[model samples]
Target chain A: MSDALHDPGTGTPGPPATPVLSATGLTVRFGGRPALADVSLDFPRGRIVALIGPSGSGKTTLLRALCRMNELIPAAVTTGSVRFEGAELYAPEVDPAEVRRRIGVVLRESALFPGSIFHNVAFGPRASGFAGDLHALAEEVLAAVGLWAEVGGDLDLPASALSAGQRRRLCIARTLAVRPRVLLLDEPASALDPVAAARIESLIHSLAGDVAVVVATSDLRLAARVSDVTAHLDRGELVECGPTGTVFTNPRSKRTEAYLTGRIP
Target chain B: MTPLATRDLLGTACRLGAALTLTAAIALLGVLLVQALGVVDVGFLAGAPSRFASRAGVGPAIAGTLWLAVLTAALSFPVGIGAAVYFEEYAPRNRLAGLAGSALANMAGVPPVVFGVAGLALFVRGMGLGPTILAAGLTLAMLALPTVLVTSRTALREVPRGVRDAASALGATRWQVIRRQVLPAAGPGIVTGLTLALTRTVGAAAPLLVLGAPAFVTHAPRTPGDILTALPTQAFTWSTRTEADFAALAAGTAVTLLVLLLTVNLGALVLRRRLR
Candidate 1:
């Protein structure tokens, strides 16, 4: 357990030392119903922030808004501002594709393309017009996710043949192959077994120093175990946010405390 | 009866129904094969049509049909696939898009003769393409375009939304996602649809007839502009003739057309299986 990124004391999070991405009063509505309402947060570089909420807590919606993926839904309307590094994400001149490349997202379904495992990982780089050696890059990322030894020899095999956990790892590897600066994972391990989930948690922990990570999960124990910072959302609103230890042990909001203790309906 | 017995009885009934349909199709094919066996010789395929039925052949018609099939496929497949990609991926989810979708669906069910009439007015007279293979090819392409578009749209829709979102999240532009992910995922279905459209166009004579495809041509078409006669037209012409041998030649031409359709369909089947 590396405590290098975790703050020592339990307290509300002050202004981040180096904010990689920040949302100020971001609100999203679908068909006139709010999915995320007046939510504001900062994701600092080299840290993992866990978003914990029950279903329909706007966790997924916030992640999608960060990457501008919410635009894919025709009825989704987003307001307020999202800034990555220093630039407005929804600026007229900003390309959503470029934003996605910089801030990669791993969806809950772990959608792997219908091709070889190598091709699945290589697809991102190739689509972004990567000019360097593709094979070496793919190998490097696959190894990073600890999939090289098992799938290296048979990179040509269809990705659909892999088990659920392997497929999830492959999705992460594919995102990493593009060398994204920020990674947003929506329940990356919720569907996996305990062992696999732990492996994913550790992998995410190890990745914090190189890339900022925001993980949205329903599992509070997983959040408590892995996150340096935790933000609790309820009914499309931010309920409480602070250092993980403080938020878990002494949440200021009754809603957050009830939800954490399984009292909320 | 027990619930399990009732379930088994329903399943057996469905199986029997399917078997009966297959049996009927095989029986029809057998009859056609028997009728076509004796008259469909090398000369019947190689020689040109003549007043004397035994001397007549389908070489020119076969060449014309091939030209029409190739040209129509070259024109329709890409355009139809492009339209389908637009509708499935890029089109806005608005009332206009909805209206266009319904219009496209209705177009798929429009009579082939209606397309033929439109092609006659549009390409033959309006464009001044004249009654040449080019004109007929364009006409048949129009006839098959709706089916290609509709089937291609369905195929593109069949690609998982998750696969599309994954590609987009990896920074692929809309075109890149469609080209690299959606298109390849839907390849087998698109190929199957295109093959089926080509088969239908190849068998159809009404469109070409509307475009004034000649019933008899002695020489094979050497270029798109050359006047042409297709297999179905030749078969139709011969079947209407008074000579008994001409009727035999008609069956032979039908057999030749059937063989060409089967070869294409079988090739598509093999391709689809390989893709899967």
Candidate 2:
């Protein structure tokens, strides 16, 4: 498949190139029940791909599989090749920690640590032994996520003191502080109010030039608004993947059309 | 019966149990206080145990108790916490690990005197440490280890899996995730567990009695090498005497041990708050 999908910003096709990360024939099962089946996709750097499906359609599972995050579940069994920077992720010698560090994920709950804002934002860099000034890096990411102004530049304030939107932004800032090549977000705005969700959408859009972003979301509007390419999944199967406008306006598969038209989940 | 009526009955039963327990505790404390009034002075606290009740003090016993508490904490805390971490974090989900975990859970509930018997055989007869404070400390450490391990594991498990996942997603190694996230998140619970284990070991008389703690020592223990003597054993010895004065001294010794235990519990409470 070509890597060039219409750029969400300009609606112009980008140059085709080798993907920064690619998954081929990926299949994942939890205790003999398949969650994702033979899903193949490519994630090119500096582009955002949104995976849209109904609940239990395996969007979150696909995102976790990309970084081998599914391995954390004891019952999860995966078969397939996921290549990041041309190296097999499931190789016996490959360190999962390194893969995860290079390809970060933000879970739906935000999951900020019960500590100061600075502590939450700086956690990834500190864990990875980043040699740069942590304070400056934390400030930068917080500012990028638009949380620094809301927190009033008080990095030491307890993370729990922040509102729901601010906490989600802090989680994003934490992931960004690690400087990953690929960013996976699962329902980043699903749990927020409209205003907060809009803020998160803009913040995610602002990340397009810096990282290869994959978003797994149930919101079709969000996928169309922020993604260059959109992949539709249903019941552990990939139905269609193409430019966002094409996927929404002229879907090839009947399943995609039905779901898009609110005829079926 | 209706659900509301059942609930009311249960509440009344609980309230009655609490009242009975409170009344019993207060009665016991009142008796001890009345008896310990004149006998528990600074001179009585500092003086050595004597044949005469008026000249007796728990100085050596108090020193021995302190030493035992220190040694028990030093030996058990690290080993127990390490074993707990291994069981929770690193151990594979296999039959052997499951068996070992079950064994630890069972051991936590075993009587302290059982550990003392093992310690007597292992440290005293087998290792030739004798009935010294070292031997008693080692015995208490044995008594505390299982309790510490069980409680620490429980504390570690209480930390949300999300915390571990978040740390792991940041590229943290297993050890780094445990050290930075899991341990800090579980700190207060661990501290409370350690405090409970330490205090239980501190106040235990059965283990020391089983280890043959001497009733009378002329001087405070200069080192762990000295003969083992503690407030529990001292109080037990004094309480066994027919003299009324000796009974008063025993109550005073018990009162002193209670105060020391309260101090330890208060310190642990403050530490837990800070950690949280």
Candidate 3:
């Protein structure tokens, strides 16, 4: 157990690699009621972190805060610091748009634009002022998501024509087109069926090599299946954080144990 | 009566009421058409207004109305839609925003004649523009502005939040999200609103009258500053002359205005459908 803490499954480490994103004493209040309180965590590069909690446990708020999206809410007040690549995300000099560009957030509902599928995928690159070939970028991202074969020939079709699973992948492709370094997914599979959910889980696992992925989910089994690290949040507090296997089998906190065993209610 | 019989009775009453309303509308249009049919001709359409009612034509009035509609649309659409975008997308959700939104809603319901008086004060006397087509057009634009703003705000608000979030997630600036996603999604509604505003402006007689649009103009307006008479004003003038020929001419002018309005509305319908 002592050796397991040092061995993060990646063999070559004297110490853990510096996280791509880190939060220190992060607290968020919306109209003076706390949504998240004093959350401090690190998201390492090339890893999948699952944020599991019940509804209103601040899982989504924390994910949004990382990319400074919480600011979009009118009364959302955030204190403390979120650093992405060693720069404060909420710094006066930092642009939220730019931060979101580097750290893409994929919402549960497939939010495709009311345009052609090709345009939906190309939106990110075009908005980011990508000077490269837009068509090629769309093709590349679509292929990465394994959606090119189905949607490639019908690039002119409206995005609304896609099925649920296809729309979800198209959204992922949209995010990938911008070439983000960190990907935050809020319940990416909650709206999907089991087969589609499994596919999305595998997709998230596959994406770990390219970007640091944080998936906020209420599904504990999904967290156990896909995440390298699991963080349990309850009532706006981080109750436990550890390796996925250890946390599920041997939780440090009674709250986490009760939650896993269906005793929290 | 049994509950089932009561439901049937209510349904029958609703159907009868709808039928009556539709029939009344058709009957009124039929009367207007019968009155208008005799005076409408190529000669009446093409000839300029004259002292002789039989020789008078609606050509100048039609042209003036077209010019007013175009200028009013051009002036109002951009400004009104811009204001809507500001209120819906850019304005912070605060008391000031709430107050401004309420004020705009109230403006939409203000009497058209009040807008005419305002146009009279602001554009004619204040700007020294005289009672030219520009002043009339500006007055009609003011009348249309509130309708455009209110309806456009509704259109913009109809854009789904998820679509906006998707654009923002793609790193689009606030303006880019609105331009690329929100506006396009809201396009059909916006077009519908603009069509309604322009149609209302074209049918307006009071504001143009307040602006002192000429009852008779010799030539088609060549510029915004040219003196002009619109269709409603022309029809009103002809109706008041107490001559049977002039009354017939008024009905003809009304039919022409109706046709013009229908054409504009149909074009807008096609545009809105295409946007959808």
Q: Number of the top candidate by DockQ?
A: 1
- The C-alpha stretches of model 3 lying farther than 4 A from their native spots are A1-16
- What's the lDDT of the predicted structure labeled candidate 1? 0.89
Worst 10 residues of 2 chain B by lDDT: B210-219
User: What ranges in model 2 sit over 4 Å off?
Assistant: A1-16, B1-13
Q: What is the C-alpha RMSD of each candidate to the true structure, in Å?
A: 5.1, 4.4, 4.8
lDDT of each candidate versus the true structure: 0.89, 0.90, 0.88
> How would you encode candidate 3's per-residue C-alpha lDDT over A78-106 as one tens digit per residue?
99998776667777877788888889999
Q: Give the per-residue lDDT of model 2 (tens digit) for A1-265.
A: 1122112333443455867789999999997668999999988878999999899999999999998889988789999999876678888777788888888999875577889988887888887789899989988999999988888899999999988888888888999999888999999998789999999999999998789899999998999999999999999999999999999999999999999999954
B76-186: candidate 3 lDDT, tens digit per residue: 999999999999998988999989888987888888888989989999899999888899888888888889999999999988888888888888898899998899989
lDDT preference between candidates 1 and 3, better one: 1
B99-152 per-residue lDDT for model 1 (tens digits):
998798788788888888998899889999888899888888888888999999
Query: Model 1, DockQ value?
Result: 0.75
- lDDT by residue (tens digit), candidate 1, A61-172: 9999999999998899999898876678888777788889989999887678887998998999999999999888988898888888877557788898888888899999
Candidate 1 positional error at B106, Å:
1.3
> DockQ values for all predictions?
0.75, 0.63, 0.71
TM-score (0 to 1) for chain A, all models?
A: 0.93, 0.93, 0.92
Top-scoring candidate (lDDT):
2
Model 3 chain B lDDT-worst window of ten: B209-218
For model 2, what is the C-alpha lDDT against the true structure?
Answer: 0.90
